[model samples]
Target: MDTEQQSQTKSEFEREPVPKSALLGFKSFIGMYAGEHCAGTELMLGPLFVAAGVSAFDLIIGLLLGNALAVLSWMFMCAPIATRSRLTLYYQLEKICGRKLVILYNLANGVMFCFLAGAMVTVSATALGVWFRFKMPGLNDLYPNSVGWVVAVAVAGGLIAIVAAYGYQTVAKFANIAAPWMVLVFLVFGFVGLRQFIEATGTEIGSLSDVWHLAKTQIWKGGPPQEGQVKFTFWHVTFFAWFCNMAMHIGMSDLSVFRFARKSWYGVASGAGMYVGHFMAWISASILYAYQLHLNPADTDVLPGPLAYRAAGLVGLLCVIIAGWTTANPTIYRAGLAFQALSPKSSRFKVTLITGAIATIAGMFPAIAMKLLGFVALYGLVLMPMGAVIFVDFWLIRKFGMQSYYAELSGKTFNWAAGLAWFVTLAIAWVLVKFAGVQIFFVSLPGWFVAAILYIVLSKFYQKKLRPDAVQ
Candidate 1:
């Protein structure tokens, strides 16, 4: 090559650092979504839907519509931005929101991600408890059930944390390898569960109506939530389906993942996760739970390990264990990325290890995973505003005659407008939830709108005072 061409190539490589690009094709995401979404937590979340009194129609229809919305959000909103920027969410946020704002955001994002992973760890450990013959907790049980349970959780958490610390490539590879097996097991579990239910109830289904009748009567019966559980209605199911992954979709966290897509159409790949993991797996798990409840109406433990073991023997148990790890591995990797952004001096590997340690501790408390439905809603709400800021700033700011990435351009230590917009919007949303008694599930959408509007207004005013040179 000519000297000029070589110089240009070297400069390009230096400016844009290259990380491993082991994730290729739609299959990687297919495995990831299926493996990550059809997880041990599904065993918990699906039962919670039943406990929340979601009717058959609402759960089925709402998931279809809501998951479609999530897919669209990724396609139109997140992927375009990600492919254009090709940076992790933290780095992108740092450029626009500045170091001070991103530090706070990263801390919150990392903690929430860790806690979420910890919950997955908790889910897997419950399965291990069955093999160890230790006492396990019920749906209402929040604290650790036994010393053996705690030890199992610790061991599982440590293994998952180590894998996560190795970084994103390993996490994706692990998911891709485990996903197909897990998906098959979940499907088999569903079929076996339905057969068991049919035998017990002596019901025969030959039509759609029959399935619906059976689902309402024997599966997801619309009843009052169990003790300490919140009631759910049609709206609750709809909103929960939409916002459960609010961080990834509405919050734009998937900007990191989608950034690598060869085309925006790759966003459609998310459907693999939503339908298989969230929809089919969720329903399958609920079937298992319903059967469990039918066998012993008084039993309320929603542990996936025991549920799967009862349904499909050792294979089911192994599915839960591997599925939980597959999900938690990526989650912990994302958490590590968030934390690593806080200290640029720290190696990503070391920071990830430390982040995993935090996740392991959080896993020790089953409350996070056990109360996952509510916790997921809250976690999504917390991180979503910054996502809104990124979204509005990237697409809308230039149209409004304001500079994008103003923090980097102006050399500002902190961008008050971005920081204040996130906090103020969240504060208002919190007031609506706590003081006005609004449902938590509905807060994220409105909060996103509030953040978007506030950022535009704040950016206009904040930029007006800058010197002529700073405007560039």
Candidate 2:
């Protein structure tokens, strides 16, 4: 086949392994990651650090360590497996977890992605709220409060969905175009916010040390959390930074994204996103929020639209909308893939549109976006066990004298071992979070180990009993 035909074939190859001829260069991934990670959500997350009462040292040091760990997880844990298999996470899961079990996982993953996209839709809609002068939901609001809010979300969500339905290359292209400008705008938010803070406090800045001192005293001053926020420590900041994208990295969702890469080392491209989006964008956003609080403590609403507008006027407002779009496009695309896995013969474009509609509806509810910190933590926890299952199945199952891809090898409709590992691990996580007083943020780390161990032990008994004679 010609290169064009091969590229087209690869784009539509949902069930089959991606051909080597269709693999993408490292630059494609870098652009995608930078654009996707430097997202609308950073607007929410940065302000959230201020609300959580994080100190400067804790937030900075924590993010550095956490983001580094996150990049490493992508490189070592996810990318290698993706390059070797050249299949979507759904397809790979189907081999080990079986068709029925994979359907459940895909549903869980799809719903979560939809909600995440919905949150981004909400962020973008807030930008509209600024332009239209509408009443937006507050930090504690659970539902849409006004007709304008609903319309804004609907319009933004519709456009974003259309872009996402065009597929990954389009998504990457859009991200590449927007990423550089969005990053610059985010930096402006920081500089503008710092100037505002300095002017307000009459603080004279002479060097980097002065800025650090200002950041410590004025921006991320350590104290009690705002109303309805969890107190943030260094560990909380670190873990939140690391595991915030746990579903993508540690949970193996990015297996789909990385499968198109020319090399496993392309995973390192994730550093662009981690540093630019998760680090710089986050800090800049936090500065903006801190300045807002400095101006009016009672204006506690965490709206990215108005916040950006206060700093850079119309350009900032435009940044909020595009930032949200860049993030949501890829997210909705991922969700579409998850849903498509359930009905392999279905039209991807149509499925993606439907998924986008669901996300738009969910976006009308403000609670998901308002409670995003907890929500994202829960999102990762819910999906992380399967990652452990995938890890163990791919690397360890054979070493333990059991057949890998047990479901595929045995032609089973469901693999009880993988299923139990997923379900039981969640159960354990729930127990730890509910009764053991463990915070949700910290539970997934130990839970990953639990899932891995459970998968290994359960697979042993399962393979022995079901296929004793076929044991390798």
Candidate 3:
């Protein structure tokens, strides 16, 4: 590609509102959410819950409530403003925060995206390891086991990156096609795994009540957490399910996604992902893990490729690979937009390619992906405060008689109030986790409120002191 083409920022619009012509139908969102949620991460995450020592009731009931909350967060917290403003999260933040502050936030956002995409690459590479009979990362492993594993990840990352570099249109198309098939495969994994458990154990099952009994006794039997895993109670499961994608919905990163919607109600389409991916897929994947435990009783490895391969043979491996690709493509694409925002003059495609390379390198280290439960929570927490900033600036600021987009109106290159609120909320959250003994999952919701209140209050004093005439 020519330098001009390479440097083009095709979709990361920094100034203009998205045109009405680009609005997508609700079904487009359904397909996107379904594909993104019922993905490679589900394979890894399902097993992690099993390690967390959750009972059947906690898992089932918690997920029902959690998934409902997640969908509502999208519909109420993210979608309305996204459709009204029709701007990418980066551009929107740049308007509220100064360009300099937004740049730093974008860097953090991009890095998180790279790491997340890296984890997906790792999940898919496991399938390649199964196919080629090469060494793969094992449970508790921190690094790539062999050269073959690295090669597999690099190959997968390269293809996924190229697809992402093409932009969101292609990514959505790929996901729309993959989501239904992957969901079907995931269901099969659960059913086949359940049958194996029944046959191998000779468990009597004549009715739904019998199945519930088996679930409590054998499948989701609650006990001490596995080594290094925390015990998850009903509340923990509920909160984790709701906030698993906290950064995207409540954190407002999905502003970019929902900006294309024809109406705010299209945000309700997120229910497709929440119910299908987080609820059903999560439960099914957990069942597979439960069956694995039944078989060996000692093997604690959480290898998705091997688990699936054992269940449905090669079809399972293919599901792992496809699921990873579908998730990683859009993630890398978003990461590229963040990077490109740092250098608006640069080519988005080249930026995305670089982001993909970073993800590929991170994928070589298996520790983060294996401990994905905690890592995902941390990543979401990091980006979440900014979402609060956006929310306050958009709706609450004017009501509070504070200037919205003060930085943009003042021609300031940095907004201290927004920046301070962003970091201080995180620091306070960290203190709660470290000193106050609050869990990571529990801190995010309060952290968001802390950020919103801090931003508004600080903006009042800071603006009055710095720009008295500007404050209403």
Instruction: Using TM-score, give the best candidate's number.
Output: 2
User: Considering summed lDDT, which 10 consecutive residues are worst modelled in model 2?
Assistant: 1-10
What is each predicted model's overall lDDT from 0 to 1? 0.81, 0.89, 0.85
Model 2's alpha-carbon lDDT is: 0.89
As for lDDT, the candidate ahead, 1 or 3, is 3
Query: Which regions of candidate 1 deviate over 4 angstroms?
Result: 1-32, 84-87, 163-172, 346-350, 465-472
Q: Which portions of model 3 show Cα errors greater than 4 Å? A: 1-14, 18-23, 162-172, 347-349, 465-472
User: In terms of lDDT, which candidate is stronger, 1 or 2?
Assistant: 2
Candidate 2: list runs displaced more than 4 Å: 1-9, 12-25, 162-172, 260-263, 344-350, 465-472
TM-score of each: 0.90, 0.92, 0.91
lDDT (Cα, tens digit) per residue for candidate 1, span 1-472 = 1223323433443324223352245555554555556776777888888777677887888889888888888888888887777666767887888888878888898899999889888888878987888887777777887888778888999888877776566666667677778888888878999889888999988997887788888887878877777888777877887788888877888876665566667888889889997898888888888888889977777889888899999998888888788888878887887787778789888887887788888888878877898889999899888889999988999999998888877777688889988899989998999999998899888899999999999999997644457564
Estimate the Cα RMSD of every predicted model relative to the unseen true structure. 4.6, 2.9, 3.9
lDDT of 2 by residue, 326-443 (tens): 7898789879988998899999999999999999999999999988999999999999999999999889888988888888778787999999999999999999999999999999
| lDDT ranking, best first | 2, 3, 1
Model 3 lowest lDDT segment of ten: 1-10
Residue pairs clashing, model 2: none
